[model samples]
Target: MRPYNFSAGPAVLPESVLRTAQQDMLDYNGTGFSVMEMSHRSDMFHSILYHAEQDLRQLLAIPSNYKVLFLQGGASAHFTQIALNFANGFKRIDSVVTGNWSGIAHSQMGKLSDVKVHLAAHGGDLYHYNDLPPASQWDISPDSAFVHYVINETVHGLQYRDIPQLGKDAPPVICDMSSEILSRRINVADFGVIYAGAQKNVGPSGATIVIIREDLLGRCSERVPNVWNYQKHIEKDGMYNTPATYPIYMAGLVFRWLQTQGGVAQMEKINTLKAQTLYDAIDGSGGFYRNPIQPQARSYMNVIFTTGDKTLDERFIEQAAVRGLMFLRGYPVLGGMRASIYNAMPLAGVEALVAFMAGFQRRYG
Candidate 1:
């Protein structure tokens, strides 16, 4: 049996998707060439791209007004690209710093000399990165170009259970959903832009998915190069440059797999159960295991916890690896254990981890 992988990105993929890719590695659909070797301009690849978008639209119920662009450069690259494109003609942008990724994005936007970066809200101030502050307390500037926030923080394992409801006159809301995209249902029309790195729930590391409202497309600054401009890529149907062809194709297959599993709604239900199973195990362990984040803010995708004993935590990780529960070590900045249960992870995998946790506690606790 294959060990259940729990690494955060370039993470675990569905067994069936891997099997399909394995079968197509040499020749995809009898095209006499691997998807890796095919021309991006060819009709076969175009068909793959078209179906991928359509399937994703169906899954998310994405509005017609939103243009989905599959582009190169990880979501991190877009931190500056977003400012170049949207922060034009404005003095400042509001950024809510809830965790590491948002903090990085906030800092990246500050690098642009033209626009000032405003801290709209920060969770670390009061919650110490354990929970989010109430949205009502966000210090949003009325004239800011856009409001930036992260829907989920992968490292800190904090997730926003409720969407922020900025008033009608507020600036556009741009979100980084790298860790939790496609894991649940979201109102596509709620934000002006949403971007995610495909490594987690989507497909792989090379492809970045940006869903931008049509009206926001024209906001790119003239000084911005074609490569960094959202409008330029959208004008060419996201083919301005030779895109990440194989990663896009892999993402297309993942979309089809999501459809077969009854789309995001059903996946959300399963994800909820999987997360609850693990969280419950942690909570029920008395003082043996503990998760610091507030229950409401805990991520359904990444569960972070610890025994409060460094030696025990290390021993748990070591023994769990032997039991096929791999990559259970937490982020270095936050030393503990993290079980990232993306959509591709089966409930059985999480159950296996929980069982191991119970056995470990029994042996050591």
Candidate 2:
């Protein structure tokens, strides 16, 4: 049997998408060349790119005013791109530090001498990963370029349940939804830019999706590189440079696969069920397993818990691997176990993990 892979990312992809890619390895759509072998500028490749964007738009209900750019850099690079693009005129960029990803972005923004960064709302030193600070307390400045926030923190297993209310006349919200984008529905209008690293839920590494409001494109200063300029990429239809062709093609396949599964609403329902089942297993373990994240803030896609003993945690991971469940190890920072159940992870996989958890607890408890 194929093992259930729970690596944070470059994670699981849809089985059907993999099978389709395998079938198309030699010839795609009756063309004598594989998608990877075809020229990026070819009419056939153009169609592929076009349909992919359109399908994604339909799935997310992205507004006509928003531009979706499939860029080359990973999500981490966006921490700099966002500031470089939007922090030119504004005195400050307000960022909410909820967990690891947002904290990194906030720290990066602070290093830009031209841009003053405001920590609008932070989980603080004590409660950094357990819960999100209330948005009402955020000190977002109206004149700030953007109020950046992370929708999900992969390592900490924390997530925001709804769009944050950052107060009236607040700057446009920028979100790093890298880990949770398509797992649920989100209002595109609520954000000035919504960016995600494609490795989780989308397709794979090397491609990042950036959906930005039209007006935000040309806000970059002259110091920003041409390749890093959102306006330049927009003018070029996200093809200014040689794009990650295979990753984008795979993303298109993943998006099409999402359509067949009844879209994001269905995905949200299934994802919620999976998280709840796994969390329930942890909660019901009678202290054998403990998830540090608060109930409301817990991520539906990544579940982190521990048996509270490092040696036993090691044992659980080893035994689970032996049972064909793989990459159950936790992030070094978190120091526990994590089961990252992205969109491609079916409920059956979660059930299998829950069963494993129960059996492990019985043996080790």
Q: Which stretches of candidate 1 lie over 4 Å from their true place?
A: none
Worst 10 residues of 1 by lDDT: 109-118
lDDT of 2 by residue, 1-365 (tens): 57898989989998999999999989999997899898889898888889989999999999999999899889988998899898887789988998888889998875654888888888856486698776787888788999999988898898887668765698989999999988999889988999999999999898999999988876866677889888888888888988998899999999999999999999999999999999999999888899878898899888999999999999989999998889989999878799999999988888988888888877767
Structure candidate 1, residue pairs in collision: none
TM-score of each: 0.99, 0.97
The alpha-carbon lDDT assigned to residue 32 of candidate 2 equals: 76
Where's the lowest-lDDT run of ten residues in candidate 2? 120-129
lDDT of 2: 0.89
Clashes of each: 0, 0
Clashes of 1: 0
The regions of model 2 sitting more than 4 angstroms off are 110-113
